[model samples]
Target: MILARVEGSVVATKKNAKMTGNKFLLVRPLVIDSPTAKEWKPGTSTLVVTDSLGAGEGEIVLIVQGSSARLAADDKDSPVDAVVIGIVDTVDVGKHILFKAQ
Candidate 1:
């Protein structure tokens, strides 16, 4: 799974039949500054991911990519290459709390 922050949304009126009602979100992958640091650093690229978890903008989410993306969707044969599988409530590294949803 990849750690990402939902930056925005995507709208598509016409798409594949297998993806008719799915919502898509713009996500920026996040990486921790270090193992001990509580800060999350943004990755260089962003991805349009199918939102399986109803994650809103600014919320941190977990993304599953490649063939696993289809597994996270309602349709087993979806064309999605990436998917937002879960919304993160909190991220704790040992005694340090890296992030907490509000």
Candidate 2:
């Protein structure tokens, strides 16, 4: 799994039959400065992910890819490469609190 922030949403008028009702979101991966970092920073690249948990823009989320993503989706057969599995509330790294949702 990876930590990411929802940057925005994606609307597709036409898509694969299996992905008819899925909601897509643009997410930027979050990276820590170090193992004991006090904050999270957004990575340079972005990814389009399928969301089922109603995650909103600016919210930190947990993402799963590949086969795990397929399993996370309501339809296991949905053509998904990534999926938002959880909305993050906090992230504690060792003795440091890296993130806390507001």
Candidate 3:
């Protein structure tokens, strides 16, 4: 699993049958400054992930990639390389609280 933030969304009018009903979100991976640091840095890259949990933009989310992403969705055969599995509420790094959803 990877830690990411929902940056935006995507719309594909023409897609595969298995992915017809799914919503896609643009996400940017979050990188922790260090094991003892209480800050997160945005990644340089972004990706589109299937939103399985209805995550909204600007919300921190958990993303599953590769084969695990397909398994997270209802249709295992869907062409999904990444999926938003969970909406993060808080992030505690060691003894420091890095993030807490407001």
Compare the candidates by lDDT and give the number of the best one. Answer: 2
lDDT of 2: 0.92
Mark the regions of model 1 whose C-alpha exceeds 4 Å error after superposition.
Answer: none
TM-score of each: 0.91, 0.92, 0.93
In model 3, pairs of residues that clash are: none
- Clash count (model 3, backbone only): 0
Off by over 4 Å in 2: none
**Residue-level lDDT tens digits of model 2 in 16-92:** 98998889999999988665577768899999999989999999999999999999986677789999999999898
- Report the C-alpha lDDT of model 3 over 1-102, residue by residue, as the tens digit: 999988999999999888888899999999977655878899999999988688999999999998898788866777889988899999987787888899
Q: Residue 28 of model 1: what lDDT?
A: 98
Output the better candidate (1/3) by lDDT. Answer: 3
| Reference-based lDDT, residue 60, model 3 | 94
Q: How far does residue 61 in candidate 1 sit from its true spot (Å)?
A: 0.5
Task: Please report, in order, the local distance difference test score of every candidate based on alpha carbons.
Answer: 0.88, 0.92, 0.89
Candidate order (TM-score): 3, 2, 1
